[model samples]
Target: MTCLPKCAVLELTYQCNHKCKFCSCPWYAPNSSYSIGQELNLNQWKQVILKLYDLGIQAFSISGGECLLKDCLPDILRFINEEGQTRGLRKEIVVISNGLLMNDDYLQLFKQNHVHLSMSLPGIETFAQHTGVDNANGVLHWFQEAKRIGLNTTVNITVTKKNYYELFRTISLGLINGASSVLLNRFLPGGRGLIYQDELALNKAQLNCMLDTAEEVLILSNRYGFVGTEIPLCAIDSPEKHKHLRYGTKCAAAKDFFVIDPAGQIRTCNHSPKVVGNIFHQEIIEDKEYWNIFANSNYHPTICQSCKLLNMCDCGCREVANILHHSPSAVDDSTELYVARPAKP
Candidate 1:
């Protein structure tokens, strides 16, 4: 476990059924140049789980445009469970999905296998606007059912300008529906997100507003959660105030985990198009240089290196840096306008 990644995100496929405007998938971009890659077969996927477990990966996050689109997921989960049981290792599995396809049968199967579900929510009435899906109400119903069925479910809200004002109300509804915890994410420009950046991206003022709303809502709900996106310490007026709010705080990409796409290529993280290497070819557990690429070596500057908050902050999304500045290590835009701006009282 010392040299290995503690978690590995295994993307089942790139094909998703929803036209979520904020989707970062490159192929989802309008007039996009990228196309879907070939997915790992059931047998190949079983091999992936086996190798990942051997590499001491403690958790496997199953995701895709929509993972349920894959016919072999149940079998793949069975493989993961069987592998964990056989090796007597503490293996964790969480499925990141839109929750549209999760039927009762799938729910029972997930519960039986000890799977955690991170379902995307579009905020109270902003669902149709954000997801381009009309069944927003159904998403909440399924979330409540999952929690009732005894699944550790997380309500994932991707904050955009449209849903920004509804942040608190959204978290409240999710909590009322029995969400075990809540996760907040700010829209980062990339892939399809680039096409919608002007429409969805939040500004510094909005980011501060979100932090205030999130902190207040979490305190009121008394739920266990955090804003799951990497935000720079300098972006917030007082980063210390959010300690109780539980910000994602630091970038955990290569430090804690790495992402593997459908073609077996490893990315710095899911939003990053920079493929580190194929899981079949890379020495993930032993390669320190590979790990260094995501440690913000290129993004951090002299000022950042000298800052006290440097260790706890990654400046912001490395993918955002790479996308906007063409340098993965470039200073985060969040910290560019001001160095430690003040938040509203």
Candidate 2:
């Protein structure tokens, strides 16, 4: 059993400027943009980062309602780089933003720090409406600017029934805007998405069609020189079309990835609220007690136990499995139904 290395995700602030209807964090605590708990100060965050590095975690991604909301983000990045350098440890830093608050100055800072940017652009008008951001044009403008400044850029777009038709257009936009890659995510049933579940959620057949379209778009985008990466589960849904896509690679979250909330609570992934431990109170990686949490939480899905691609698929995200079965231990059958033969070498 190869235990995957870990990557750290720091949530600078839970305060987001735009209220996207599909946002899960917002739904976790309604009536307020900020979390009820105290936000981690500079020193506290520094400790968390340093501790993670000491625990053998090297790569990190900073996100939030909008990571830019934190005034200390630059300082935080600077500290991480400096500390990492001191230890002779190479670290990759990434930030996921809505592209609403970043400007030329911000871009320069990110470039100077060697940070990769993952920007979110839901879709066209339909996505804009869902996020309550009146100016989708403004978001696109920054995306182009970020690329111009020589910053590596990736686009994250959520797929839903409302914007399913524009899937190709969105991929095209990302490529045109110089996005190195694009992430097509299925609309998870949580947060603001819960209200519009009926309107935005896709049935089994509809989801299959969407996955097929995604594969076609990815092929077209790659042909034109754009690197396209689809969400694991979505790609798994249409294995035949995405057969060229690799499987059996360890998930990013399971390997070299972790998410820390604004208050410094760390978990395996953002979608999971299961708090493995808090960076503020404990060094989760070094503490065998905390690491055991994940060990006890089985990764192999019951349905996938006998599947040839069981290791390849990892039975999709744990959060997704729980959603389908209404229990943490329940296995999702969707992956089994959608599994297909791997592409011929």
Candidate 3:
């Protein structure tokens, strides 16, 4: 468990331009995300990246309320790109943005640095309903433009009751237009998503439909992609059927990757509000005890302890469980929503 993770997400800033109803930035929630001007500046952020690189973390994801809102972003990207070049290392850098601020310069920078870019597309026809803007076309256009300039792109989709039916079409539009791959996250209520939970949440039947649609599209398109969030293995209807989708099972928090907020606080994952420690103030290895919780997390949804798929699933995101019931030992909300085990594959 003392071994470092492979990727680190640096949330550059909480400032954003979009007002999507499903915004997951911690600031939009009941608790304040950070002090108004407490976010690390360009030099401090540079220090963070250097510290991470020294810790042997080679991949980084630059994200935000909207990353483009950070004036230091271009500098941060340039710094990472230049550092990798100077070190003769091919560090992986990914930027996930809302796409309202994407432009040619950013695309070209991503192309030159080999930074993979992902754009969040909530839905096609109902995109305006979620983001308060009818710019889904513009997102697709950004994909086309990214392709034209030779940058790798991904369409990041967050599925909820609001966009459940349009899931497949959204994938098709992105892939056909120019997205090289897709990343889907079935909504986990947190931050702003918490307030609108009832209106945006997806149930078991609807969740299955979305997965079914996603599986078909990936196979038919023959593209490379995977789901970005964890789901219960038992809830998955067919083990063989969903195996190819490569979404998530069990939990990868603090294992495969971790998140660092704008104020330099380490979180178990992006959705997790828990801060393990700050990288600048202390050595990350000093906080191995905090990561132990995730490494040795309890079986969520007590029933998962006896399920045949116990080894393969941890009863979905514990973060969701914590958010809903506010107890570390509580079961995931999906446990109640999905009553029966998915009839074994």
By TM-score, the best candidate is 3
Count of backbone clashes for each model? Answer: 3, 5, 0
The residue pairs found clashing in candidate 3 are none
Query: Any runs in candidate 3 off by more than 4 Å, and if so which?
Result: 31-37, 283-290, 334-337, 340-345
> How does each model score on TM-score?
0.90, 0.82, 0.92
Candidate 1 per-residue lDDT, tens place, 1-345, comes to 235467888888888877888888755666765535688899998888888887877788998879999999999988888788888865558889898887998888888787888889967788888887877677788888988888888888999888989898888888888788888888877778887888887887788888888888888877556887878776776566665477775777876878888878777678776665666765643444545766534456445666776666667787677767777777566323235432222
* lDDT tens digits by residue: candidate 2, 219-288: 8766222222213343345455564223322334444466788987666667654556666563444434
Which has the higher TM-score value, candidate number 1 or candidate number 3?
A: 3
What's the true lDDT of residue 97 in model 1?
88
Q: Pick the winner on lDDT between candidates 1 and 3.
A: 3
Superposition error at 213 for model 1 (Å): 1.4
Residue 57 error for model 2, in Å?
1.4
Worst 10 residues of 3 by lDDT: 334-343
Candidate 2 deviation (Cα RMSD): 4.5
